[model samples]
Target: MSMLGTKWKLHGNGKTIRPGHVVAPEERLAWPLTIGIGMQHVVAMFGATFLVPIITGMPPATTLLFSGIGTLLFLVITKGRVPSYLGSSFAFIAPILASQQQFGVPGALGGVVLAGVVLALVGAVVQKFGAEWINRTMPPIVTGAIVALIGLNLAPAAKANFDKAPVTALATLVTIILVSVLFRGILGRLSILAGVVVGYFTAMARGEVDYSKMDAASWIGLPHFQTPEFHLGVVGLFVPVVLVLVAENVGHVKSVAAMTGRNLDDVSGRALMADGVATVLAGFGGGSGTTTYAENIGVMAATKVYSTAAYWVAGIFAILLSFSPKFGELIATVPAGVLGGAATMLYGMIGVLGVKIWVQNKVNFSNPINLTTAAVALIIGIADYTWTIGELKFTGIALGSAAALVVYHGMKGLARWRGTVAEPETETAGLPPAVKSAMNSAAKRSGKKP
Candidate 1:
């Protein structure tokens, strides 16, 4: 068969491939290939998607159901132009736990709803003014610091779980690292799922697995949905989380744009609005706030398939699986230690990705303005710093993000006031030559001059 007739094509080191030959996001493959690829995405996202609900004591089935619903909603909002999977967000885990403690699950859901509203409002601003204003305000330094803070801020949670079952957690973490580092292609892409499976088996061997729930679970059932109760006090506690979500969504969109060699800045507002609406919908259903999954992005990077159609298939699959109580119970059987191991790796990767962003943007650390911004943001975020006034509280990732924006922009203003010619930001300088060449090629293909 000719290359064009084949269902799959390889773009290895020596192969000469044209940009036009690539499978773009809007294109579709045959059903069999699409289903298989979609399933791979499902596996890629499964570990982290379920982990958030598990951590926050939310119903896994409900979370799974809403994830599908949210992704579908997002696709519709973006007019199916963007390929993404919406999953429960880890950024809200701390806030959810705290809100639940103070105001019960319904009240927590209320706070989540309000946070979504806040995100939507921010999205409106992005839509009206364009993403450039946001870019100017946050920039690489601020966004990177906030991203790193997200990962670092979650370290204690991972440690707490690890402390419960050290051996199992360590085994899980090791297995993930080995798979990710040593394997190639799909296996490496699915490292987190592999780690979870290995860890679960390890836990089983250690007699840590509990089959009681799985055995008792029904074969099929609807998720138990809950109604949110609005509380003014709890809203203040959780509204700040929108800052982290904004930073996260912006980064994810930019990463996807880079990977696809397409400029998606045009839809930045729509993406944020979709995610915000998804979060609101999920909150109404007793699920965590949802965001685009980076795990799926890694899968796309590995497989070289960026089809939006595959995401539709994946969403449908998730929707079907969500009705299976047995599946939810099975996921619950995985020991906490196993989760800890995976979370540790995932969270650390998130932090490193922040640094990667800085490197990719060629953020100048030598500049006192950039240096001070990043320094203060990291410290505030990592330390979970907070300030309270009356019933309002600014803290955690929110505080860190605020600090980053204020510090960076403040420095920029001061510099301009002093009549100093700020250094022009340069393209990535430290990246490998081959990678840079590829980026240039992608830029050219996308009709952007490199």
Candidate 2:
């Protein structure tokens, strides 16, 4: 393989591939087919990537530009061993809003840069040592608490947007639900995007969309760019995001490894470092923080093509698209109602994912440490608790994340002191109906047996 693995031989004469066979990362189809797949990658990533900037009041073109750049950077840093596309991270939504209030967008960017540096450092540590310590530090219970709380805390914001145009939001949500059920495979996976499109049309019908801002944008021009400013105050808002990024990257590596039937544990650290660097680049260049996008993963899963060559084409396409300010402006025209509709499902899904993590890991609620850790954190997060010191402040997500870690560790240590820890029960019958419902709902959405 070459340095960036840009050299790829033909995969089966660049024609139809047999079932149960896939084009490896180092192999690609003929020029036209590969280009088509690459464009498909762009469409797959379009909705979720643009939503981050639209929601956070950042320039959509700028974010797209960095995403393209980040994907290329990831390929280079990982030495093309891993196949992934970088996109804006949803974990930054709440924190960016919080930091923007006090320190503005630049301040939020500062936090992003710092978080990337921290993640990169963790990656270096993992590369030198191993990833076992990460599991020890953030066990399933603790990680679940943090992830769930972050989502639950955003409920109020979702409601606020939903209130802006309740009818439109409702229609959007309904469309999303229907689309997921009506279509199978790739379309079902893209329910969010489908819903957004339906909602946009709904908003238009309601005469709520404003088209004036888009007229000024040119077809060919540079995207709006801004510089990050240092802000020690918002550091707390973004550091927890590094953990989420770590989980996402690790999961990406694991997923690719599973599909490719390759041992990717060796490059896990490099994967993390690559995403960290991508995020750092985004922060400095006025874009949302980047992460390995599941949307792209979904695309690869459907096509059974794990070609890095396709991703290279996708990156170039994204860069070219970013140069068109008119497209960026068009994206920005999405109404709050549509965003609210998407967020309602998206945020809840994030929370449920945490619960899924618990279920998958068989995290024992019967255990006091696990129960207390989750209970306290959920309340603090759902209630939107706040704590302020002389100059530092902690809101729901920050406070909840900290509480989960401290409570889990404190109770575990005390249990050890008293020798009270015991085996966890694996019975699903003991779970609450709400939990079971949520889990089943999630299972259906992911196309797995519930």
Candidate 3:
């Protein structure tokens, strides 16, 4: 029961996952199946993680290595209570570039390190103060909108992939749907991974999978690395990103809580500090700042498996893979079309998970404050609004999350000042122990530990 403990008791039967049952963070499945799901998560986070470094003109290998390291670090810090994958954050891109001109790449990385320290400090505050105030400020409606907008904000990224090879994208998307419907047990749970396999081969047939890099890549090599050089000027450019990262981490906690029907609010601070620590490590060795990846969260939503053990596998495997250029190149061969199809499904799932938060919490949209909060925030996020002040940039998720809080509190406060009826909020119940009943049944039948 240790919050930071690594042990994951086996889930029911460790083979078949019955309907209405999800694998919890502290539980695990058979090694083979867990390994597959873990690999699926790696594939899920790969594209976006590498893109940050690639776009910022930093070495992609360095980012991958740190991200993998960060993922494992996050799992440990959260004490296995929360399941998440740490990946390169898009929020860092603009600021890192801005800092690059003034402070150079090393200094930009230093800013990342400092930002992580600030984030960790924020986590420490939440840890000391408790996270209830976070909930007070952001109720179900606001949190739900925050999660929904993050997913919707990536719609264009999905569409861009869809456009690359419509036929291939459709095939991949269709396969994901059909596999879930046609199969049960492990295959059903692995539908996304299955779709990826089918799509890869399908793309190969269409001459979309490029094998050139795979052939040229070496079997083993070290990912490029560099140390940070501190610069105070870079702070202005990067620290603002902490706001977006906080919103994302909080949204992730809420989403997981909603999906698992459990109250994960307790781990909010630890999750934040974990990312901060992970990012600090990334900065030390020239990697992109990390955040909990929505892409991997989408995979969990699809799989119904939230085992932190799988993340351990994914993280360790990523570290191993970072040294292999051939493997990196091979993943790159996965065409935009395959990614497009996956993005379409994964991103949309995340958006809906936000709405699910509303449904589960019974957020009364009939209240004008609630309705407007969702309305304004969703539009800002889905439209991918962008605003810049000096060297700082704020984009969809950051803006949308901020918008939800402002719109909700602003309207609610104004109504209260006017002595208007402030609508009452529905309470969120503690999530049922989703795996508990099944575990009891299996243990009773087998005379084993529950």
lDDT of each: 0.79, 0.87, 0.79
Residue 199 of model 1, lDDT score: 90
In model 1, the number of clashes is 0
Candidate 1 per-residue lDDT, tens place, 83-166, comes to 889988877877787677767889889988998888988898897788787776667877788778877777888888888888
Better of 2 and 3 by lDDT: 2
Model 3: pairs clashing at backbone N, Cα or C within 3 Å? 3-79, 4-79, 261-431
144: Cα error in model 2, Å: 1.4
Candidate 3 residues lying further than 4 Å off, grouped into runs, are 1-64, 75-118, 226-268, 283-314, 427-450
Off by over 4 Å in 2: 425-450
Which 10-residue window in model 1 sums to the lowest lDDT? 1-10
Off by over 4 Å in 1: 1-20, 233-237, 255-263, 419-450
The weakest ten consecutive residues by lDDT in model 3 span 422-431
- Candidate maximizing TM-score: 2
Instruction: Estimate the TM-score of every prediction.
Output: 0.85, 0.93, 0.70
